[model samples]
Target: MREALIVWGGWSGHEPEQCASIIAGMLEEEQFRVHLENSTSAFASPSLSTMSLIVPIYTMSKIEKDEIGNLSSAVRDGVGLAGYHGGMGDAFREAVEYQFMCGGQWVAHPGNIIDYRVNVTRPDDPIMHGIQDFAYHSEQYYMHVDPSNEVLATTTFSGEHAPWIEGVVMPVVWKRRHGTGRVFYSSLGHVAKEFDVPQMRTIFRRGMLWAARD
Candidate 1:
């Protein structure tokens, strides 16, 4: 059976555990055997040799070198790494090495939790194919991004955001390859309501399937 681990929980604002559960259920429907870790140590001590994927649904947590190295080795060996919003990138905010490996992170969204648009870019990518443009009332992330990712979607600041910032593009969805593994990220899902959006659900489903390993 294909196995996956979702290590969620740092701050309740992200509803990390519940959101993790939501995505885990989606994976279960696809026949994946899933495990949910409720806190920072949920997947600690490394040894992801048996797992096919690692999803960290977190925000602003600290990880030790041992913990990071353990998770790092798993990805290097081809374990799919994926998550959305703060859970993946915003996670371990203080850890430089963690941010470096994850690609990018949420810095500040001057829009301050308002509605905005997300336009899918990589229409040819299986994970984003057939997905149309959508809008959501969540924190549109203005981030310090990693140049390494293959951005699949972008959102530009407007309305209140326009007065302060220019037409700098914010990546809504992106993917990067680390070792033999696939790393996927989406800068959405600040609340459960955001998760319920149709395009958001579609994107989440495709990301899960795309992150699964053979």
Candidate 2:
């Protein structure tokens, strides 16, 4: 069976623990041997490279240099990495290398929790197949994303919150690669309950499976 490591903990405002539990249930339903750890130190595990996937529910936390290095190397060596919202995008603010692997960083959520629309960009992509543009109520993430990402979905900023970015289109979901590894990210799920949104939950599930090592 494919194995996955879910490391959760950091800024409780994001409800990392709750989100991790929800994701763990999802993975368990899929029959993955899921391991849950409530600490960043799990990233340093020597077995990281052997796992089929890694999910980070950690947000805005400091990761040790060696820990980050191990995690990065594991992904580069062909393990998969997939996550959503601040868990992956807003994690390790000072770890540029980690951000690079994630293909984006959550820079801001201009209006905080607000109504927004997610427009599917690459519906043909397996991760986005059958998913359509949908209304979302959460932080409309404005991110600094890698140009190389194969963007799957996007959202437009109204500038009501950050006037300078009015009408700017920002990536909402994307998939990319680091070495031989597959990496996927979505800027949805600001909180655990957001996972109840069918579109958001389905897209995340497919993205995780898509990023898993073959």
Strongest candidate by lDDT? 2
- List TM-score per model, in order: 0.94, 0.98
Report the C-alpha lDDT of model 1 over 1-214, residue by residue, as the tens digit: 8988988878789887678878888889878899887766655545575787788887887887778877877786788888888888798887876776677988887757887888988899888888878777888888888898899999988747657677777888888877777788888888766777888888877876676743
Clashing pairs in 1: 58-87
lDDT of 2 by residue, 57-92 (tens): 889989999999999999999999999999999999
Global lDDT scores for all candidate models: 0.80, 0.93
CA lDDT of 28 in candidate 2? 88
- Candidate 1's TM-score reads 0.94
Number of clashing residue pairs, candidate 2: 0
lDDT of 2: 0.93
Candidate 1, lDDT over the whole model: 0.80
Give the C-alpha miss distance for residue 171 in model 1, angstroms.
0.9
